[model samples]
Target: MSVLAAVVRELGSEPVVEEFADPAPEDAADVVAAALNPVDVAVLNGQIPFRRLAPPFVAGLEGVARLRDGRHRYFFAPEPPFGSFAESVPLAGAEMTAAVPAGLDPVVAAALGVSGLAAHLSLTATGGLVAGEDVLILGADGQVGRVAVQLARAFGAGRVIGVVRDGDSRRVPLALGADAAVSSTDVDGLAERLRAEAPDGVDLILDLVWGPVVGPSLAVARQNARVVQVGNSGGPDATLNAPSFRNRGVRFLPHSNFLFSPEDRAAGFEELAARAARGEVEVEVERVPLAGAPEAHRRLVAGAAKRKLVLTTTSGTD
Candidate 1:
């Protein structure tokens, strides 16, 4: 009953390919694809606060897997000893699992799961983003930010602007649905550019890279604008301008995937999966073998990947 898995055999050690007892059907489901994310990388480094599993535990938080009826399903927070990085993993629950929409690739579903849900909920549920309002996405070149840029448009935003690392990184967001993109490195020019792009001020700000951008973004925010902090990829801390935020009457809403209820998660996935199936949203994915997970983790930590990295059961050689 042994199956291949990417196991963290020691603290601070790279995940290695190993054999572990296969999860029984009643307790686990077969995984088809496991998508790597910032949190997964954090878990590996013992950075996730709630993650306390020691060495010998499987690695990965969520993935797309096949259900008993042979349909693809997405699940999150698998049992401690087994995770999504293996051929099979313990199921979180029926509430945490959703059928992949027809025509959506399992790899894409796995890649989009938590990130997509974050974007959808940030704009609609949390930000109260409505039609005819301007939406700004910081770190829009990254996975969830890119998805948020597209979702902002699909959700009927009058304008969608993205803040990327530089001019070179601007095209992807623009092509994905953003009306314009500003460079994050252009610190002095950020406020000007934001004003130029969103003359009336941005109604909602999806702060994916919160640190450096928060201050400048707040300067261009419309009165009563809602800034939803979704990720801290740039850095966990930010020096904010209190007066600007207070004068604008802006609201800062911090978001975590854990804040979403089971019903909300399922609904988010259904909406995003349908969008993917209709080709309205697409994720550029790089396939890697489960054995290459260590290398994948290294590259991801270094921020070297230009596309979504997905690990599958296939041999690493392609």
Candidate 2:
């Protein structure tokens, strides 16, 4: 059977919506909503050397789908060549699928999977966030960073500071529960600004943009602080001052969603979904039809999209 999907015909090219063969019968599920993430762009541009896929494959790795029995599930890591940016996709097994919480919007469920898991797990499981401790979130204007700001507050952080790229972007994190929002635009003065906001030093740091901003962020870390590094949106490389880093005894923990176990990922997603359903946590999302995948990819690559984008099918609305 042929189904509509966004197909990547080549590396560095935008995904084109077209009719593609349906997922194999044994593993097939009808897609409801699929999220568009930076990782998907990275894979499309061949930035991830190890996870390369040949052209003519579906475009998304995860989404909300309907099982054969009409039960809704949020599935991850769909079998390659048949991804979630389609009418139907192939699941690896039951292990890759989790039940979406009751009354959760399918688009929000899909949006919360990759970005939400990264934010929630980075703080709890990876950064070892403790109640009443001070937290610092770099790149807090991004999807994962936005969620981190709210999660930090929800998890009982005494103070939460978010560092954003633009001066105007400060309002985003501030509105989302960050105690203070600092701008990284003035790289030279970042340390001074952060120190002013967090005089006692931060206990946990979620570093999402690891460029020149990292040095200033580390400068404000209290002794024995845990720094969870999740992304390099600012840049791939960073230079750390040897003495400042060592003297503070900062524990640099690198985080990736792929490193987490299936059970942990599922639990994290469920918790985030529930919180979103209860209105305790919120993420700015832009809904687009599946056929708009090409334009969405272009916006993502150009860094013009500030909100999380979720592609919805007719099934998703029902």
Candidate 3:
């Protein structure tokens, strides 16, 4: 059967949806819903280190799919060029796939594939965050940041502060679980503002924005504070002074799904699904049809999407 997929034919080019041959059960699996994530855009733009991918390659990293036997699962990091941003995609190995619990929203499950996993692992595994510790999430208005805020609260953070671009986006993080929200646009006084919100000094920081926010946040971090660099949407470079961090013994952890074992990935998905089932984890998503994937790609690349964007196939995932 023919399938529709978003193809990236050139480096740094916007993906265009086109027809492609469908993969059989032995070859791959069928995607029911796919999410437009920053990794997909980064890979298409040649930011990732995949040297094997050539032109006209499928571009996506995660999706919700159904096995030939009709079992629903969340698929992660399908070997690139045969990614998840399609009406159908190659099945990932059993190690990278997880059964989706009944009653969880398929689109939300697709959106949470990598982002939610990263958040959960960052706090519990890397940060070693303890209940009652003050937690701050930079770029808290973004998809991963939103999940991190909620997860931080669920993990028992005493105070959760979300840093957004402005006051308009503050409500998103607050509603999710943040005790307070601050705007990154508070240029000259950003550090002061954060210090005020976190008078005890932040114990752990989930930093999605690495540019200006990170450096200032580092200055106010408490002794032994752990910082997880999850995303670099603001900019890749972050300034750090050796003497400053040395005094506090602050640690920087770069969290990625690649660091996880297949078993680890599956368990993370299961826990996230369970949280969603209990109404603890919820994703605010913008549903776009599979045919509109090209436009969705365009908007996501331009940072136009205010909410997580999930591509829905004809099977009613929307």
Residue-wise C-alpha lDDT for candidate 1, range 1-318, written one tens digit per residue = 889999998867778988987887677677889999878877887888877677788898889887677678888878787778898877754337777986888888988888888888888888888898988899999888888888887778888889998899999899897889899897877888888887888888999898777788887798899999888877989999788888879999988767888777877788888988888778889988888998998998888999989998752122
| lDDT: the better of candidates 2 and 3 | 2
Root-mean-square deviation per candidate: 2.2, 1.7, 2.2
The CA root-mean-square deviation of candidate 1, after full C-alpha superposition on the true structure, stands at: 2.2
Order of candidate numbers by TM-score, starting with the best: 2, 1, 3
Give the poorly placed runs of model 1, Cα more than 4 Å off: 92-95, 314-318
TM-score of each: 0.94, 0.95, 0.92
Candidate 2 accuracy as TM-score: 0.95
Off by over 4 Å in 3: 25-28, 92-95
Please tell me which model should have the higher lDDT, number 1 or number 3.
1
Residue pairs clashing in model 3 are 28-91, 29-91
Q: Candidate 1 overall Cα lDDT vs. reference? A: 0.84
Compose the digit string of candidate 3's lDDT tens values, residues 209-252.
Answer: 99877888876689998889888877898777787777899989
Clashing pairs in 1: none
On residues 46-100, what C-alpha lDDT tens digit does candidate 2 reach at each position? 7876458888888887899987787679998676777888998877653477788
Candidate 3's TM-score reads 0.92
lDDT of each: 0.84, 0.87, 0.82
